[model samples]
Target: MKHLCRKVVAGIGIMAMCASMAACGGDTAADGVDDGSEMTVEVFDSLANYQGEQKGWFAKLVKDKFNITLNIVAPNVAGGGSTLFDTRSAAGNLGDIIIMGSGNGQAEDVVKAGLVADISEYIDDTEYLKQYQSAIDELTATANQESGVWGIPTSVSSLAPTESSEGVEPTFGPFVRWDYYKAIGYPEVGTLEDLLPVLKQMQDAAREAEGTDDIYALSLFKDWDGEAMQNGYQFPAFYGYAEGIGYVLSNAAGDDYQSLIDEDGQYVRALKFFNKAYQMGLVDPESTTQNYDTMYSKYKEGKVLFSFWPWLGQAAYNTTDHKEAGQGFMMLDIDDMTIASKGAQPNGTSTFIAIGANAKNKERLVKFVDWLYSPEGIQASGSQTNGAAGLQGLTWDVDEDGQPYLTDFGVKAVSGESVTVPDEYGGGDYTTGASQLNVSTVLNKDIDPNTGVAYNYQMWDSELAKRDTALDVDWQEHMGGARTTMEYLESNDKLAVIPGATYSAPDEDSKISAVRGQVKTSVVNACWQAVFTSSDAEFDQVWADAVANIESLGYDEVYQVDLANSKEMTAARQEVKEQYESQSQE
Candidate 1:
């Protein structure tokens, strides 16, 4: 209901340049006036079904320690939400610091608006920020562009790549519920056909048990679910085209030669599969209207046997308080939802952060930002995940009534003004909850992912590791939808080759989005019809025909653009990796 974009004008930005070939070294320190001037940082940090909130944490710390006053501007009080920040920037009424998400394709807009500083020049300045020369350089090079500095990478986490298990049968590879599958076990359930016979039997079992027949597999969110509505410009690498993080890149080369969707006929195959699932009655009937809570509930109630989700979705079940979710649900990756594993690798083009134009204190904001990247800062933010961190803004053991109990403000609601938390730490700009690690206080108490990892850090990493082993077809290479990728496709035709996509202003961006909004719904509708029917040739044709019309309408040109962008990505990643390897040499 509230938007934070307002008229954000000039403030300090960062710029780092190499001092000399010989690396002169000196750290920059801030000289605080100790004026204790209170700085108000209006942020977006709400946690609800509709609106996101605004917050200031380091601001709280600054307010608590220094003479500076930290005023948090909420949407209700300011008469403006986050989007108002953009509007105010045009009207020249922004705050000192702002929070921006990295995944959205508007970094260029923010940069052009001059709402953020050009910090690119100071990326290598050791005096202002220290201890991560290698990592810092990597961030800079990745954002390198002749056009602008745009945004810097924030948050930090890196883990050693675990050895890929080959001989071990991937736990997710196809399946039949062992209980009902024995009599007619098709022996396996991974490949497309390898799953059919068992699905038919399951359908029969459901019909026989209930007498009133009609069963389905894979659940769908009513209308459009999981961000399918967002990809109004270009379809994403996956099938349903959901947003947020996913495995999309091919490899270091980033060519996308290894595709989940066959370069030529990904849509056709996807449609066919939707039809196949429909005919088999493997999809859940409620999938079309189920929210996440509903779907998980169905799984628990035994309403449907199998469906697709992230590997640790079972963990979300969390049998008891303080107990892990998905602890009991066995992952069956085979027939439920799967795809070719030998596809492109998805890179970390995820959530990022930027300062607000209205931040009350520029110096404080910089200091705060630098602190977050520091080992101490990374440790602080990672703790605020999975309801473990104390109250949102202020986590405490003491309540207002002098009760020695937690006066919680809801974890996600408490904090605000996040810098982009790196994928290595936690996904996106999640700067709350409490560190996912439990440490011995001396070490800032955050998880050090290198050797002695913490619980959540290991949990996420373990989840990523199981990706190869679990193989939910829906999540494999491509599931379905045109979330962010559609937008990327429409605006940046060049990116189809890789490194760069042609740019468009926000107006053009909106028009393209409108076009995609219509197309995507058609896709979901086709899927709804196809999957509802028992697995059959007739149902499969309807699905295929739908894809054919979509392809005829615009997919060919769109896909060509993707090819070009894919090529460019290959070139860009190669250049960066070469530089990263050289810089990482210690």
Candidate 2:
């Protein structure tokens, strides 16, 4: 650790923080002597009012641990925006830590710039590390090799779920307005052929109601988590039908785990279906660039009939709307997950956060992280304590007669539009951080104290159901971070994670990524375009060309790497499976 620190300091080339900045890291761990001072930067991320009125619990924890004052940075970057990242990197005025909201595209850049430390050395030693074996395995597989350790893998237990909710039905289904579905004489959407007509019916309904012919049936956006919620879950659910069990299984029939772009298999079948959908107006034509805010507009404004949306807000909102219009709202699982056209699979947590090299005290930070995952940690970070924003003065402690009594405001909030929650929260006030630490419980609940609305109730409930129903699905999920490299691999987006384990960078990975950029997006898009045209000649030509480029773009070596790594991992997974089976037999 000491040698690595020295190397980092030397590699970073003695451009120590300015005297003023150096003054901030008071008593915090430093490479050199403790100058009896500490440094702090206004760290920022996705959370709103993230500072929690200056004395937030998170802040207090840091302050107590390092004795450094972290004057919480204001103007919290809204929805994982770029203001903080750009500001910090440009001015080199980065804080002691820039906790990225998720391992989106930023992680790649963070690794490449050598701006963070490789906290991997401490992973095996941390008490909580054992609980996060799978995550560590995945992190090791995807991380850049240059920094070796990159960021510390946050052992956030809840966010590290193995599978998501499936609802009452067991098929590849998500929560839709099942009440509305039943009322509408639920159509036969058991196949691609069925979905296309339903999309048409939706388009026609939109045309009749809104008089806009161009308004699409499905609205997909790629920002503000657009692509994820939009295509990531919804499309795959449907796409897997034609693609078959391969979509959910450990490997396609003839392919290895890393062979995502093996066009001869399930993916190609799925792509052809997607191509058909694209041509038949089921998918939004202008969907490639829309953001989340824009995507929700179509749903909220009633522009389309059937679309994928969060059952929680959508159900609550629709119910509220019906009350206003003399009707009620109801949501259902829509019998989709069961009517598998293609496959069934696992859905994990929302996002990933890795520790920054600049984290003032790395070991302490890891301890703090582990503490957060403890029952108490989750409760404190959760809505129970109203976030790490401020002090949590309210409680649901049981009162006389054994009734759980919340504060007066909590009682009054029952009749209000939303539940009223206390402004004061976090920092050892209500003391949820010291409570029960059930990671699974956290995944199953996202209760908002203020609104009294389980905003994530549907998401959680649906995910829970998914978990139960998928007990027999022949599927294994490959989980890791790959956003930036994905964009770089778009033409051939399937080849994004072909490398086994992680890439340390400047060696094989850099080489692979550069070549991938050339053959990714454009090549795949072109092939799909030709296929959609239904021109056999064009399709054949494009397919031939894509295959031809495999060697030229270094895909041959990439494919070989995929084979070697994928076979090993799959074999290991199978061995584990057999071992479990044998143990069960005993």
Candidate 3:
């Protein structure tokens, strides 16, 4: 409800940049000073949903550590909520901080409109940010000519640690309920069809157990529709293509690109599979109407047996009861199912982070953001994920080997078994919650540069192994092969390619931006209609009609732009990868 943007004259901004050690305003601190002001920043990030109480543990932790309170804005698909940028632009009432979605040219658009501040000069003074100079360079090269570093890459592809050295385990692929599969004799599912009968059996068992006839074999949500039922985005991995819903380079040269709309394409096959599930009454009835929240709730209730992503399924059953009974969701190496992990791959763009041009707490907010990327910030925010090491002696403590090990109380806290008790546990909402600042950035390596101690994922696994002997094991004794779905895919060389990482020229963006809405609407409406067709003949007719409609709407023209962009992106990725490799060698 509060606006943090402060209107300042152009002369004042130029003067502030010219001054060496002066604070920008009375309230704003100099470059690295904790102003200790109680600023409520209206944060708009689409990727995260911060629903915690204002005085929750994580929120309080941030406030105490950074001297700022976060006023997280609710998510809105249409124009990013009530504080519309267009309206704010007119009224001069934009929020303090804004995070733009990656790859869609939102950053470029905002910068062109002269809304965000250019922090290029400030970034040079940041200790942690200096390491990402090359990444910043690449970003600037592709960004608007007028705006320099308007949005730093929250998800830095170039700054990611090498695969061997990285501790974060990428989660993507097919997941099934561990309890349900074991009950059904753990039948082999080498193909998509093989999953049907097993799911049917599982659904039937759920119905029988609960005395309810409303169980579903598979659940679906409609929010991800971005130019077709974006479920097609997840389908290509099943056929060995690593990329999701975009042009894939055909050869070693990255000169040629292919679209995913053929009659026999992965998208088509996926739709047909869903249709078959629907005809057999295995699909959730509310799929067309239900949102992600509803689907997730059902997942938590153990009503859905199959999950496309590991995160979705894992969240539902990752509790003390499920863990004690070994009944959580487990990923499987199904035949023909290729798992894809969108690891810290350098997309020339980022889910852009930019400070408002009129931000009152500009200096403090910038310092807070810079701290978020630093080792201290990353650890405090729980970027390590496997071990969210924060609040020493409560959530975790340093061991004799200088590694961070979760205390017994920390384990119970994370596992949702008991309250986390710190040495000085002053109570005000003692619930353990995730930090609101875990944005994508360069992950500082496992060994801390300052302390020369191992932390992050390396230490997390070590401590986990100490507690659970079978912790590292990804599969059950009944299942033979890679430990997790990601491992299986990596071993067999089956990872999906992310289209967003691909490059497109500035002109291409301007051209496609105008036509994207038209193309997406036509494709999604038609494809969804075809998916719900009753008979095989009707499905064929609908599919053909949809294809014809797309062609008539100039789909090929838009696709041509995508093809060129893919080729360019392919070459860009190669160049960036080589640069990183050369740096590592140096």
Give the best candidate by TM-score.
Answer: 3
Q: What is the overall TM-score of model 3 with all chains considered together?
A: 0.78
Error (Å) of candidate 1 at residue 324 is 11
lDDT of 1 by residue, 233-327 (tens): 01232222212111122432242342222324443344455556655556666666667677666555444544433222333432332122212
- Model 2, 174-202: lDDT tens digits are 33333333334546565544565655664
- Per-residue error at 61 for model 3, in Å? 4.4
Model 1, CA-based lDDT: 0.36
164-280: candidate 3 lDDT, tens digit per residue: 223333444667776766677777887876777778887777778778887787888888766577675665555444442233323223443446567866667778877777777
Report every candidate's CA lDDT: 0.36, 0.38, 0.58
Instruction: Estimate candidate 2's RMSD in Å.
Output: 11.5
1 or 3, greater by TM-score: 3
Candidates in descending TM-score order:
3, 1, 2
Q: How high is each candidate's TM-score? A: 0.57, 0.54, 0.78
Model 1: ten consecutive residues of lowest lDDT: 159-168
Better of 2 and 3 by lDDT: 3
Give the better candidate number (1 or 3) by lDDT: 3
Q: 562 in model 3: Cα distance from truth in Å?
A: 2.6
- Candidate 2 structure lDDT: 0.38
How does residue 203 of candidate 2 score in lDDT?
Answer: 61
Counting clashing residue pairs in each candidate, in order, gives: 138, 49, 8
